[model samples]
Target: MSFKYMPVLRSRENEKRAFKNFFDNKIFSSNTIIPLIEIIQYSPNRKNTTDSKLPEEIFEESYVNEFKNYDFPIIVDIPMYIDLNSNIKQKYKDFLSEMLSNSNKKTPSKRLIYFNKLSKLKNIIPVVSYNPNAPYPLKTISTQEKYLRTNFNKIAFRVFVNINTITHILNEVEQSITSEDILILDLQDDDYKETKFNTLFQKIEDIKTSKKCKTIILNTPITEDIIKKNKNVQNDCPINAIDNSIVFSYKSFGFDAFGDYAGIKKYLGPDNNGNNYNPPVTYNIFYAYHQNKYIKFKSQTINASKPVVAPSITKSKCWNMYGHTHHKNCPGCIEINNKSIDTSKPGNWGTWQAINIQHYIYTMNDFL
Candidate 1:
């Protein structure tokens, strides 16, 4: 049986239309824009999962891309708002300023209007541009019908349940456990630490049995203490050491890539040809190729951080993907050994991204 209140996926056409409407409405608004921004700034901050914090303006950037990338179009059932102080209002103004400056590349007038709308939002959570506002956000549903219709290739939706509500969802997901694998990133402890060895191993076993998740990616720092603790575990999850030479190799370029093979010493550079062999960094593009998903478990970088579920990979070939700086040089993508090749483009290089839970389940269901 399906959950009653869970939001259903919408048709791709409808999603596109709704998103267009959302943006279009903002562009047309005058008196409404500043209040909207106030609402967003005043709203309680959402939690982020990565330890590396980005400027608040990044969310504004995300708003622009969400339209470009998402097919299903995520919407909250209510108009969520935030309450902001003078400091936050100024920060948001700066973000709006940057976005407005860049608007000339696309629809300049339209973007400006949208920014104006953002400025108008007052005392609201700033649910993705069009998400419905509610007195309390609970049991929100994301419809993906539109994404499927667009042939948008890879599309996934993540519902950001408050930390307080996550345990409930986890319980629901666990109880509904079918053949679909349910992986959990228990952020309570470091993956490579001995102090948490018994705890980690026990959780792993529990997931293997009850949760039945196929792959479980643990998050933990490779601190000296944690490393010392893991000395006894003959086998451990691929540890992407921060100072590894291979990590340094690719990082010197750009593109933050990270993955299991990233820490492999064999891939390290200074070849006989005097070329630098950099390990891959993790990005959304890589995850798409691998068909994976990423979940933020512990984001220590940002104040008022919340874990978010997003693609470990992206379809865009333009920019190399990077996540929070959990471990420096955690290569998510690998470069082919060729002096003449441009590694950033899609076809020439290889990388890894995370597998979304929804898509993973859908795939498993098909396989069965």
Candidate 2:
């Protein structure tokens, strides 16, 4: 199946919610978008007693299987922080084998293995990072190469680099990659700059000139800093629009697709101690995507004393006007329109995240 957008989503509950809701409702064709699911490291439990789960355990519990019923390819990726040591490496391989074997069992061989549990699943694309700064760069490259040569028909080899290292990384991996594979150029949370975009455009031209890979995806994130800065503006509940011209600009250069963190921030740091504490007071920040710009809607702070109240954004005239003008009638929009669906409580943040992501995917499909 062909894909137009590559949304870099984490393997977490909120993302799962978004995927399931989007696909189950038949909102759009699954083939329209390919989700790059990053298997985030497990955090400590609420009690904070035990250590976090190893890479293998996290893989086993990943939400990848939730999309088993979908027709499109799903790219599963391990974050860079998880070192590819021998033990964890073997576990990852075994986990993949088990998932493939298990998938074949539940469904007929002719049908695409949606976690069939008995045969190999052809649509699960594995990601192999080629970052030089990562531990054991040679080993990482070798592991990625092994995946490319072995089980999977296609591999998404990713590199997170800036202008300084783009040429080096591209040259370094040129020999190992093939025309069939996907190359991910991850520009995580970098503020947009003309010079940087031009340099990247040239680098991509070089890759195309060399015929390094046929499918190259460019991914960036809408950072919290951007959201905060916009919210601080003088306008009341201002609609913060994120510029996406950089993504569209590359389309003319024959780039396969564009991607982002699905409105989620890109976290590259180590796992924090598992402390899931809800603040006594918080604002309801909602997100939407329209006309290639990510829209952020912030509400006044909601105190814990009145957890049941709807956020001010929902009650404001601005939201009402925007809803009528720009809303896509997605599940998120429906929820927002229904003032009874309170997203004020801190625990309900996932609901909002899922809403934003669902709408974002819906809008992106229309544009793509």
Candidate 3:
């Protein structure tokens, strides 16, 4: 609700662990950070039939109960890759309505004013996807519009559009959107160009001026290609410094906030259908976030002739040289610094991810 930073997090154990740990440690204020929780699409392994679970099932088992633990407002979205099932859509809306009603009942007299003020912003915001190129576009838009009109006080509609297609997409969906709804412009892995950005900013301003949408968010990704390219140049442990130049550039336009895929790349993996994927021999790569940059601690590669025995981020030269000074002394950094956790175990991959996400959220809150 009126957040400065929206970190797009997938509905995975790692992200959940990070959010809970961040909240428990009081690392950042809830007021400034509103996590956009994307329900990850289910990808089944061909060898394991039981591994497959429907998106709706995942929501009920993993997220429905977890919503009570978070005090801050969260934006729930179904990833664009997933087929928008009507059953799941209605279920999510029902869950949000129930949560809002429960929150209203729990508000104390002393906090009533504050509660009312925040309630106006809506405690649970649902995201509707609008992509004209998608299959059955009219049906998709109509279903989402009906869902939004049913119970949600305010909604956020997500669309992947660049300067070239922004006008067309806006015109197509203008009737479905409202002034109160939030417009999320997802620039997935698009490199920033000054002329394009200038035009895009003007388009956003035009949307607001025309009352097409009042709140707009600019979302982009730090692609895997960027990280890999930087790593190849450095060879050793590379410190990748990415600035928020694009995010800050939109400040003058009165955009609501900036969003990103946290520190992880956007998921473009296998579809919902099962695949014959096999596990590969690879070492864990530790990550640390500090000062708007990600420091990657690369261990021995699978094909390396000689193996390095560094098991955690603390063992890396970068950690010893600058991590202690550059990183925040939060729970994640403390866990890595203490040298107690193993970063190699399958479950512990989540720990490593949690570490970076924890730091990313902390850094973004301060930066924003």
Model number with the top TM-score: 2
Model 3 backbone overlap count: 0
Q: What lDDT tens digits, residue by residue, belong to model 1 across residues 103-190?
A: 2233332223343333322221122211112232232211121212122221112222233444443444344333332232322223
Residue 88 accuracy (lDDT) in model 3: 37
Arrange candidates by TM-score, descending: 2, 3, 1
In model 2, where do residues sit more than 4 Å from their true spots?
42-58, 61-67, 81-119, 131-139, 196-199, 209-217, 228-231, 234-242, 267-273, 284-296, 300-329, 339-347
Clashes of 2: 12
**Model 2: per-residue lDDT, tens digit, 187-289?**
6655545455666656665675586564555555455566566665442343444556655655775577778766555543222333333333234444433
* Full-model lDDT for every candidate: 0.26, 0.54, 0.54
**TM-score of candidate 3 relative to the true fold:** 0.68
